[model samples]
Target: MRKLFVLLISIVVLSACAPVHRFTQLRKLPREYSENYSIEGIKAPRSAAHRKPWIVYSDRVENAAYVNPGGRVKSAEVGLLDTFLVIKTKGDYLRLIKYNPTNIKHNRLTQRKKAEYVGWMHRSRLILSPSSITDVQSGLHDKLLTAITDTTAIMQSATYFTTADSLKVFGDPELQNQTGVVGIHAIIYALKHSVDKRSVLVSKTPSLSADKIGEQVIGWVPAVMLQEIGHQVFTGTAFSRVPTLQKTLKYAPMIYPYHTDSTCSFVSGTLEPVIDKKDNHVFNINGKRISYTRGNQIKQELKRINILFAMEQSSRLPEQYPMLLNAIQNLGPFFAGSGESFSYQFGAAVATPRGMETIPLTADYEILIDRLVKMASYVADTENTPLPAWKAMRSALELIGNTPEAVNLIISVGETGEQQENAPSSIVKTLNEKNCRLLGWQLYASNDDKYNNYVLQLSNMIEHYAEYRTKNKRNMILYADQFCRSNLLREAGPNFLMLDYPYASMTQGGFLFPEKGETLPMELFAGAVDSIVTQIKADHQLLSESIDRAFATVGNGKDRLDSLLIATYHLPQGVKPNK
Candidate 1:
């Protein structure tokens, strides 16, 4: 009985260890052999192919290839013991496949530590799975770093890449072509220096369309050229050393357009001359004027004709020869009816031609030039002298002879107290007969006694002559200088009187006053004048009230006083009482 129990225990243990598919074939066996039948007609077990173990590093498994036998094996049915044994035999190969190029910790550890680990793997004692490794090489890393650095450099140097919605590239064809070449060269150079060769080829080639290429080229070329030129102009040299050359070179970039259009050209040649009828001189350059009274009709005509002739001649010359042209025509009518020699000289200079052309010898032109030259020379020579009365008279005659239409002669009179006492009465008489407008005789004022007496004598002689002309049906004007209150409204019962004041005040009084020292502030002087005007108006009102009161108190008797006040006030119409 004990032997039977031992055999049964043995059978039960073996059955438990049998393959699971053995039961599916039991029904086909004979009844006597069913419990102990040999599994026949089964296919011979295939010999296993040599398995090369691979270590694949993946997120789901850690150290699985080393610790687990069939973790990543191609066939899990292979004995787990056999898989673990195979992993051990090929550990070096597994390690090599699983090496991580970017393992910072492994790389940073001591060389001794790395060697110890490698040595264990070689001896098949240590295994590293493929999942722990990454296929990163030193050469590729260096290439990436270089590409990044190059891109940074390009971005830093690119200055002309603007984001404006609309850009104005100067539309000239020639300029655009030159700019294209420069821009393309610059961009290529920048790309060469800033990007990896491979990246530049890959990124910039096929993607850049023809339109984009042209726009970029055009935008950068002129910009770079202008920037370089600006630096040269500021720091490389002085302007005058090669001014025109420098200008020409700078405008080389602009020449394509400038040459084709008149408005675009940047050249100015010469200015035209202006003729001053009152001064009888042509203004060749600038700064010329003339003043004449109504009587100088002949001189005015001559002056106008001279200016027109000069302009006509100027038009015939090259346009570039004259940079500017300014003519003051018909200035003689402004002065009270008299033409002064100095005035005519000034007019002639204002109208003088600027070019080197042979001035046409028309009789009018010759006469105008002769008169102008004579007047200019005389004024230049006699500028400092006190013009004698007879000499002044002769100068007037010369002016009238040169300009036949000259009907009036204006002269400057001495100040109220300083008339030319020795002025010949006959000179004034002759001027009155000729209907001359004498001016500036009243302008002379000085602290000097002799000058004052001379001015007084001159004024008296002028009055005598004016009275004679009035009786003879001829017109005459005695313009007195209002240098002081005494000269303001002289009772010189002449047909015409004009008050002349100095345009500018001088420490030592004269027409062209010199600045001797600091002068009063204009604001203060203006304020003072305003105050004076207010006082004057108040005083005039008081005077009018007094005249009205007197008229009411003595109706008929006040007539004489009213007449006296009217005369004193110089009122054109008689004063009336208030309603």
Candidate 2:
């Protein structure tokens, strides 16, 4: 009986041991398993296949990678400018594998405490290049450290690092001389600091030297030993572009089909009460403007206006053409009644024989729209993608003339990719010489990576151009998407603005109406559109009132017009005239 009991106990113990052994095997499996874990089936990002090296752009500890997507197990911590190779990507997450160039073997405690240095990080935490790191290291700022005393020993693990007197130290000190001068000072950048703020991991500056040693410099001294360096702060702001009443009407069809004539009349009278009527003529004293108070006699002033619409027109025109026509139709009454001749430039191509001549707004509204549509269509079909922006600017300037009488209002839609060729200084000089106030609109019609990059680059270019001069705030740019706004909006906030394209069904259908049964409320959409139009109309009327007062008080209509342009930019909420 006792023998039988022993056999049963043996079976039970073995069964328990078998499961534990399997569990141990499971634990030994690689952390980045393709078949299991949170990163299962997660492929690399479009750029990750290239295995590009990225550097940590931020200095915060939270900008770190983990063993898994669950983020429970932190494999390693990276400080500002620590670079690692991007091996894989899953949505916003990137798998970073940082190889410790300094590979020193350690025993027991020290080895176990060593950081893994290979894990998954978020894309936002990384910058594609190491320019910032290189700049700081090579800059005039001092970034070196020396042992405060001869007894100060180097450490192997930052976690267990100590500066106390001891017979034996858990680190290497080959770089330190008998005089306590550590030759690694200038080359050694303080890579990372410990949690207790007492120790730091030091490594050779990759930009300064080609030497990769087996032993990384350890931190046996407190952080106080390292000199503090201040970083240059750059603040940029992105201003939101409030659409004109005419621009808002372009999206009216998506809400519900409506005649352009009827909508124009409906919007012309619609006004939202904001500032007082007395406040409307504030621009007369500050800048030049047009007025209608002259009783049946229209003030005939030479007004130079140019519109540049540079879309990737080949593939985009089919979707955008109708809206463009609608917007132009709504703009007819405003520009036509202004008693000033206006010229319209369309597409990204060099001016054709017919396009070289300016199309006056005095032409019948319907005829004007038809001519524009046909012209834009021809230009898109004939010219290659992307309008040569600098050439186009020069062309517009030539058409408008550089004289003070020109007073050009150049509204540019989209920009070219040739940033260096179309330098900011050149653009600023061109605008100033032409007496032009530029208003740039960057369209983000798609989430395509290439398209997004193009728009962002365009935004940056506009910003650089705007920042190049402070004489006039009227030279501004508006972004179509929030992402672009967030990216560009910094300390220079006044120059950037968000131009909200209200038609969700057109731009963001997937996000707004995800399910088959989901339908947008047409009435609410129309109300929102009306609200926007009303506010825009009120702003437009205010500008008109200011112009009326300026022209009435008239010294030289041209000089007053110039001052009005400057005063218009200083409006409480500002205003964007119809394109």
Clash count, one per candidate: 80, 24
lDDT (Cα, 0-100) at 368 in candidate 2: 50
Candidates' lDDT values, in order? 0.26, 0.35
Model 2, 1-579: lDDT tens per residue? 999999998887776553122122101112222111122333222433223223233223335678776577887767544545344466767665443334222211122123233677765454432211223233422244432211122213222222111111112122121111233123345443445666443444422111222233332234534433323322322212334644665555233333575342122211221212221221222243312332112222222333333233224444444554566456555544433223222222233323432343222455556666666555445544443434444555555543324234444433223434334556566655554434443332344444344344444444443343223322111112211211122221222332222221101000011112222222232232233333333333433444453433432222221233334334323332111
Give each model a TM-score.
Answer: 0.20, 0.28
Shift of residue 1 alpha carbon in model 1, Å: 99
RMSD of 1: 39.5
The RMSD of every model to the true structure, in order and in angstroms, is 39.5, 26.8
